[model samples]
Target: MLATGLTFVAMNGIVRHLGTGLPAAENAFLRFAFGLPLFLPTLIPALRRGFPRDLWAGFALRGALHCLGVIGWFYAMAHISLAEVTAIGYVNPVLVTIGAALLMGERLSWRRMVAIGVALVGMLIVLRPGLRALGSGHLAQLCAAAMFAASYLIAKRLVERTSPAVAVAMMTATVTLALAPIAAAVWVPPEPWHYRWLLLAAGMGSLGHYFMARAFAVAPMTVTQPVTFLQLIWASLLGTIVFGDQVDLFVILGGGLMIGAVSYITWREAARRSPITPPIDVAKGA
Candidate 1:
């Protein structure tokens, strides 16, 4: 999860440094296009080994959810501070936790609720709804976070029945296909340097997802999730010192609260997950 955060931050930094002149759709397409080669080997095995057809519809739905998230995430990152984007967006884990309990009948204990409550406090610190002005970037971040949570939950169920590598490959390919026409129609001329960054974003995203897959293989969502909140700390530091982004008291306090809440929720979930291994296979190995 920490690795995923850094990769995402780096992807954002690369995209932002590339400037807003780049078309969002085109840039997004290019990233996944570049990612294709890296994923080819993983794809081979998954293709030969298929999931039940019944699961494909779920995969498509989840892919669409994730596609929306990727687009919003790119749009927000290109326009906002990397730290701000990262901080706001990383709350999906908490959302997933709540959603799972309600939807999946996953066991929920008081400890998880307390952890979630504390995390909400942290989010409020960053958002500071009553204290400050809100921007479109904030709105984009919120949407992206929610969509990401929905996508991951879908993926979680899908992973239980399919290979993680296959699930990721399908998402990338589907998103690329979905975005292609839109990107081509609105395409702007990109310099060689622009292409370089686009390619880098693709690599980071694919690698990030790969690491995430591996992490999930080793641990349950509850066990592995808290570590992901660490992304906020990376974002704050990266945004301030590296990007020279100005800091506000509310963001600091709110972000910390959010992290604390998320962390607590994760820790409790980890404790309560029962056995480390699934009575059956916990993961389809990467």
Candidate 2:
């Protein structure tokens, strides 16, 4: 989990470094496109076996939603401070809980409701509407979180019918295909240096996902989920030291609240032996 947090933060730092030189769609396309090669080993076998035809629509839908989320995340990286983006993203697990109840028919207990409410309050603290202006970047992150949550709910269903590798490979391929035309429509010729950084970002993103999966496999979500809070701390420090972004106390406090709420939800689900809400790693869109 620590490695997962570090690699993801490093990937975000690279995206922040890239800024808005390329369109967000193009940037998102290139990141996934470059990462696609890393999955070829898994993709080849999965292709040879052939995918279950019934699951194609699910994969396509998930790809489209995740593609949009990636575009929004890239745009947010360019527009907002890393700390703000990271803090806002902590709301994803909460969003996933709501999505699971609405779309998957999961029961919403009173305790879960309270946790969700706390998460909403935490989110409002970070955004602080009325007290301060909300920018497009802030709105984009919130939308991205919803898209990511929806994608995750779909993934839970798909995973029941297929292997994790096949699911992941198909998602990467579908998202790459989905992003291509959008990238081309708004394409800007990237500098040679952009390719180098984006490739590195792709590598780090893949590594982060791999580490997160491993962490989940070895430890319970209840144990692993809380450790992810370190990511906000890392993001805050990195934003301040490297990018000169101001360290907002409200962002930190709110993020902590959200993380606490998420951790409680995970513990409850684990204790009940119900369908555990997917971890916030979906925020990384593995």
Candidate 3:
């Protein structure tokens, strides 16, 4: 999870860099196009096995959700500070947790409820309503976060039934196909340097999603979600170092609160799963 967070932050940084003059749809299409090579071997075998109608539908839905997220993320990163984008992206985990409870029938304890409440407060602290008018970037990021959460949850379930490689390959292929028309409509031919950056972004995203799928396959969402907060820290640093963006104290504080809430929720979850020690059977021991 930590590695996934680091790679995702790096990818997002590259995305922001490449987003400067490129339309978001084109940037998104380019990402999947470049990443396609990594999945060709796996995708080929998966397709040879015969693409069932249901499988195709599932992949299409997943791809559409991811495509929406990629477009929003690209647009937001181009217009807003990376830290702001990352902070807003934190909402993904919150949505995932709720979705798990409501849709997947996962248990949601009062402890988790309190944690979520704290996280919501953190979001308010970061956004600080009325202090500044909300912009397109913030709205885009919010939409991206929600779509990403839904996509991730679907991927997690799909991973249980399919190989991670196949799941990722299908998503990549579908998203690439879905974005083609939109990208063509707004396409501005990119410079060689832009392709280089975007290609690297695609590589990082491919690696990140592979690890993410494997993680979800091995663990429940509750077990893996908290570690994502690390991305916010990495993004804040990247924004400052790479883009010369200023770090606002309020954002840090809010992020800290969210991290704290996630940590407590994780701890509670772990405690629940720990083996109970049987009372010492001193009376029975001879």
Candidate 4:
């Protein structure tokens, strides 16, 4: 999980560096372009044997939604401090818990509700939108989180019917193809320096995803979800050391409440569900 966090931070650094020159949509497309080759090795096996039509649809929808989320996220990352963006992004899990209850008809317990409420309080601490109010960077982070939550909910449905590897590969392929035309329309000649940052962005993204895939393979959702929360800590550290970003007391307090809330929700979910083997939860950026 720590590896995942760092790679993603590295990815943000690369994106922030590159977005100064290129369009965000184009940068994201380059990421998928570089990433496309990586998928073929895993995709061939999944293709020899096919999944149901419904599963394919699920894969497509999840990928499309997530691609938009990534666009929003990359745009946000380009403008914000790592900690500020990431602190706001932690709300994705809370969004996921609510999505599960509403869309998937999962049972909602009072504990989960309270946890979400507390987490909201944490978010308010981080945002403080009223006095010395919200800025564009912060708004972008919040939007990214909301969009990512939508993707995860769609993904939960997809994973139930297909392997995570196949699902991931297919989604990457679909979104890559989806972005090709847009990238072509806005394509600009790239500088040598731009390619370096773009390479780092793409590499970190691919590597971060690889670790995330491995983390999911090893543990169930109940186990892995909490591990992913370590992002906030790493984000803060990176922000301070690398960029000299300020540490807000609200961030610590709010993030603590949010993490505690998510932990509570996960615990309640584990207690309610059967002990049968199931796929792990895959959390991503807001």
Candidate 5:
């Protein structure tokens, strides 16, 4: 999980660097395009084993949600500091909690509701709505978080019926195809050198998620999920070193509140679900 957090921050830095030149839509499309080859080995085996035909549509929908998240995330990265983007993104798990309640018929407890409220307060503090105007970047990140939450929920459902490898592979392929037309429409052919950067970003993202999946596979969510808070610190450090962005205390404070809320909610849910069975961890930004 620590490695996953570091790699995810690294990937975000690369995205910010690349997005300075590339259209976000094109960048998103390229991410999945280049990353698809990495998943081919896993995807091929899953294809041979086969899953219900009905689930393909769910995968496609999840892919589309992922595409939206990617587009918004890339756009946000280009326009905002890495720390700011990372902090606002912590709301994802909160949103995911709500989604599970609504979609999966999980019981919504008062503790979870209060945690969600606290998270929203933290978000407002980070945004400082009345004090400073919200930038498009902030709005985009918020939208991206919600989209990611939705994608996570759908992926969770799909995972019940199929392997994680298959869910991931289908999402990659579907997102690549879905975004291709838009990417091509606005696509400025990147310099030959840029492909190297894209490949690096893709590699980091793929490996990060792979490690994250492995961590969750081996450990309980109660143990693994809390470690994801390290991502905000990593993002803050990377922003300072790589991008020369200052670490905003407000962002840290706000993100800390959200992380605490998420952690508590996750623990509560895990305890409620089963004392014996390990709970599934929430997906983090990649």
Candidate 6:
């Protein structure tokens, strides 16, 4: 999970570094397109064994949803501070928990409900709609979070029936195809530097997804989700040091609150040996 967070933050930093040089859809498409090769070894073997027909719909759905999320995320990175993007993204886990309960029939305990409520409050603090004008970037991230949550919930189900490698590969392929038309509609030729940076971003993104899938294979999303909040700290430092973006105190405070709430649930689950929330093995390397 720690590896997942670091790799993803590194990818986000690269995307931020690229700024708006390329259209959001094109950038997202290329990220996955370049990363597609990384999964070929896994994909080839899975293809030889014959892809399961039953799982096609699930993969397609996850791919489309993830593509939308990535487009929004790329747009958000260009328009907002890295810390703000990460802070707003904290809502993903909360949305995931709700989806897990409603769609996957996971139990929703009172503690979890309370924790989720607190996390929502933290999100509100970060947005502060009335106090500050909500920009397109903020709204984009909110939509991205919802899409990501749905994609992750579908991934949780898919991983049960397929290897993580195949899941990641198929998702990459599908998203690349899905983004092709959107990217072409507003396509702008990228410079050589753009390709190089996006390639690096692609590698980081592939690694992040692999690490996340491995984590999911061994533990429930709730167990692994909170650990990702650590990225907020990394993103804050990176934004401040590298980008010279001013750190918003509200973002930090709200992110800290959300992290605390989720961390509390993780701790309580481990302490009580809750059936709904299983114990995680951090050393297990997911």
Best by TM-score: 6
Q: Candidate 1, clashing residue pairs?
A: 118-261, 119-261, 122-257, 122-258, 125-254, 126-254
Selected candidate, larger lDDT, 3 vs 5: 3
Candidate 5 per-residue C-alpha lDDT over 1-286 given as tens digits, one digit per residue, 9 for 90 to 100: 7898888888998898876698999998888899999999988887787766689789889889989998999999999999999988877766776777787776566876897799889888788888988999999999999998888778767766665666777888889998999899999989987899899998898777677555644443334545677688888888898888987989989988888886877677677764533455445322
The global Cα lDDT (0 to 1) of model 2 is 0.81
TM-score of 6: 0.95
Tens digit of per-residue lDDT, candidate 3, span 1-286 = 8889999999989987775698999999999999999999989988888777876777889999999999999999999988889888989999998888888876677888899899989998888879988899999999999999999989877876687778888899999999999999999989999989989999999999988887777666766778999888899999999889999898899999999998987877677874322233333211
How many steric overlaps are in each model, in order? 6, 0, 0, 1, 0, 0
What does the lDDT come to for candidate 6? 0.90
Whole-model lDDT, model 3: 0.87
- Candidate 2 has a TM-score of 0.85
Clash pairs, candidate 5, are none
Considering only N, C-alpha and C atoms within 3 Å, which residue pairs clash in candidate 2? none
Error of 1 at 55 (Å): 2.2
Provide the RMSD of all predictions against the true structure, rounded to 1 decimal: 2.5, 4.6, 6.8, 4.4, 4.1, 2.6
Residue range with the least summed lDDT across 10 consecutive positions in model 6 = 277-286
Q: Residues 169-234, candidate 4: write the lDDT tens digits.
A: 777787787777876888887888877777667778777766755554544433454556777887
Better of 2 and 4 by TM-score: 2
Best-first order by TM-score: 6, 3, 1, 5, 2, 4
Regions more than 4 Å wrong, model 2: 1-3, 105-109, 211-227, 264-286
Minimum summed lDDT over a 10-residue window in model 4 is located at 277-286
TM-score, predicted candidate 3 vs. hidden true structure: 0.93
The residue-by-residue lDDT of candidate 2 on 1-286, one tens digit each, is: 7897899899999999999889999999999999889989978887787766778889999999999999999999999999999988877766766776777676777877887799789889999999999998998998898887778677667665665555666778899999999999999999999999999998898767656555543333334545666788899999999999988999988988987886787677678887544444433233
Q: Kindly report which residue stretches of model 6 are placed more than 4 angstroms away from their true locations once superposed.
A: 275-286
TM value for model 5: 0.87
Once model 6 is optimally superposed onto the true structure by TM-score, how far is the C-alpha of residue 150 displaced, in angstroms?
Answer: 0.5
Error of 6 at 239 (Å): 0.4
Better of 1 and 4 by lDDT: 1
Quick one: best lDDT, which candidate?
6
Q: By TM-score, how accurate is candidate 4? A: 0.83
Give, for candidate 5, the lowest lDDT window spanning 10 residues. 277-286
